[model samples]
Target chain A: MTTETHLVVAVLTVVAVAVIVRMVRRGVLKAKYTVLWLTVGLVLAVAASVPTLLDTVADRLGIWYQPTLFLMLAIGFLLLVAMHFSYELSRLEKRVRALAEELALLRGPVPDDTADGGATGDGSG
Target chain B: MRTAVIIPAFDEADALPAVLAELAAHVPDHEVVVVDDGSTDGTHRVAAAAGATCLRLPFNLGIGGALRLGFRYAATQGFDRAYQFDADGQHDASQIPALLAGLDDADMVVGSRFSDDRGYRVGRSRGLAMALLRLLVRRVTGRRFTDTSSGFRAFRRPVLEFFATEYPMEYMESVEALVLAVRSGFTVREVPVVMHDRAAGTASNRNLRLAYHFVRLLIVLLAGGRATGHTPQVAR
Candidate 1:
């Protein structure tokens, strides 16, 4: 049972990494920005294959009890999920800004992003 | 001289008003170009209120990205000189005269806190890190720069063009500017200036992380300052 579970997890991990790399190459994501996320994923995948690795990390961090395999997997997944949401939020924000700028232009710059260049009564420090 | 002061502001609304006021009082003849690098605060309103020519970057590109945009604007607008002024109120506007005066002999003039009696305080680790940086700059550029990471500096047209095309868009703009200037056979001079602690906003780096950035810059600098094609002569 243990051997089968490890094999399944390994296959899934490889597929996930391959997908991420493909997405990065296709410009769907950026490699530099995704390094931390990819590293967390890879570390979790490797740790899952070797149960003893948890003891070493736990000892180094001065944690008393050995962390459960499920907990480790959950924590790693949470981090990667957070990263995904961050990237998505930034992308959405960019799209919104573009839309806002387009709307402002169509409306002939009615006190939006383009209202900055004119003279104003506000003085400097 | 037609000068443009490039102020890269990141959520610096609280401190910028005072800095802009000082600039107006001291360097009013120069056109101010505030590069608002996607600040969430009312930085754009403050800059606009202060009557600065603003360049709103769509995202929070780092300091290098902001400065490169500023340099490009300066080049296109035909400014004779551009000064990189910090938005955090640490740089003194009163030193603009000394910086501009030094520009006659050198292509770029750097304002150094250690060059005068003015004392700037940070964590002890930062001081050690800057000492390491001074060593690295001495080794790499063959010039003794007391503060290689100070953002308070002025660049003439030639140095402005060099940065507009080849400025590395990261945290290493101060060091990279010095290296690029030296590599391009441009004379660089350091002048006495007062540096104060920032009035508002926390620094992005704590002590240990600050050391990490210094080490990162040294590695980038030692990698043979040639990748950006800013240097005319190939490293031997």
Candidate 2:
């Protein structure tokens, strides 16, 4: 609840929100992803402004230190963001595989008379 | 049915010419596709010079990715069967007929090296890994497979289409693909085939990498589910 700590938190929150908004406006960050970052920034700002709210929540959770609570929440938020990135990575990997398959097939030879003959047979020699 | 031989090559410039030659001599009737998996050598040129239809990937996509592309080509080009062969010259092209013969009753036919004691021996580590995979696949599919990691195999049209849509892009895709096939209601069989040591180029799996790959593949096979939803084609 020190004045200096409050000033630092306020500045950091403002910078985070401004950067996120600028990225969103430049289309570098999609709206869906921006929402998560925006929420994190807003929560930090609110927690920093209402210093007593942090102490009350920490007391209810049986934590002696209020900063630890903030630290735990920040860590949990980061873990969720990391999990979301992993899901996005998995999806992109699948799409890349599909695209690679399509590109290779496009580069292959056209089906011809021999291909037709091969298709009609019993495929047993 | 029309059959195409899909050879997935990665930096096999030294061995591709002879492999293509043997394939041309042994199975000239079948369409041959050499998918050059972003080799930094003359692999594409060698395949093209040998008269095999060569598809060069812009970058390396490993064996699984290359084979998936082959399946896509087979399915889209209306091939009735697609045969997977290795460009390392380890797979015998002459055994392709036996694979095709097995296709008469099965949706997928694997050219197994251990089915009839063809005398193909692996190192202790690889043997143990293969044994574990065989047991896992047998338990999952209720059918025993002697060579679950064999790259040489043949697939019917429906199986080709299924794999073209979805396949494992992992270290042990060969074994995983078989599990996928069996789980998707496709009949799978194995035929004995002789294999040779690589004519050239070092194996992608070796030493520390092999150990890591074995662990990773074990986890993936144990945790993964069926990869496709296509119903098996009725027996011809």
Candidate 3:
């Protein structure tokens, strides 16, 4: 790898780590999710700083280009994150639907369904 | 046994009044609950004025979500049976008794427009879509449903409770709900009823929407019914 390429990767990894830390501090991102981002950033930094490590791994895997190995790893990491988010989203959707049902019930009866000639002032309008 | 009529209405202020009036006149003994699906107009007020219970959703959850809310209300309120009626005035209130009567031998009763030699006109595209859905449902459930998309239906307590907890929140929920009901070991029967066109406003099903709905419903049914562990409770 060129010295300039190494420098770029190092700077990008540092920036990502800084951003994740800021998000965690601001409570925009939870600590649990931040761990995943931090690990990803640290792995990128390690691979970029030690190009020989990437080269050996790529050679063992019969890859002609070492950079392609790094690209593949980054893609794999992103795919994992996306799948995790999908599962979280599915859970959150179910919770939201359940909450909505509860809220509707709490809002009280529609006038005709009630027994006492319709409760006049429940603010259901 | 107590019964609740669940009407899920979205922006149907013009049409809802008459439907509610018909319910009040014909089915006064039953409880009428209109789920106002976050209409921008006076749907909630109209339903209230017509002496129907109005459950106002904060936003539009579409027909499926609104009906689920209605089901939840019915189940929680200790209703023995629940009927799904349309706010667009397409479903005849007078036929509700027949639907409930048809429920005597089944867990769920569907008011089918194509049953009992009842002639209801359908557009070419919609007729074709209904035919395809009928074929798919028959293939999967080993039962023939002449009108799989009919919104007018009645459900006994167990089926109502099941749908209250889990229902398809998508475009063609009626079709999907049928699949779910039959797959979950609930018997569904169809009774012929005369259905009229919307008294006011337009239906949401246009050419493009119908095409999209057909593809989506086909995918959902083909993917198999939703995995709801709803064991049928003993009927009351």
lDDT of 2 at B229: 21
Stretches of candidate 2 exceeding 4 Å from the true structure: A1-8, A108-125, B199-201, B224-236
For model 1, name the residue pairs that clash: A124-B21, A125-B21
List pairs with backbone clashes in candidate 2. Answer: A118-B1, A118-B2, A119-B2, A121-B1, A122-B1, A123-B1
Q: Regarding DockQ, does 1 or 3 come out ahead? A: 3
Q: Which candidate number maximizes lDDT?
A: 3
Interface RMSD of 2: 10.5
Q: Which scores better on DockQ, 1 or 2?
A: 2
Span of 10 residues, lowest total lDDT, candidate 3 chain A: A113-122
Which has the greatest DockQ? 3
Each model's number of backbone clashes?
2, 6, 3
DockQ, prediction 3: 0.36
Q: On a 0 to 1 DockQ scale, where is model 1?
A: 0.04
Name the candidate that leads on TM-score.
Answer: 3
- Report the lDDT of model 1 for residue B217: 78
| Chain B only: TM-score of model 2 | 0.92
Off by over 4 Å in 1: A1-125, B225-236
TM-score: which is higher, 2 or 3? 3
Q: Between 1 and 2, whose lDDT is larger?
A: 2
Q: Provide the overall lDDT of each model, using Cα atoms, as 2-decimal numbers.
A: 0.73, 0.79, 0.81
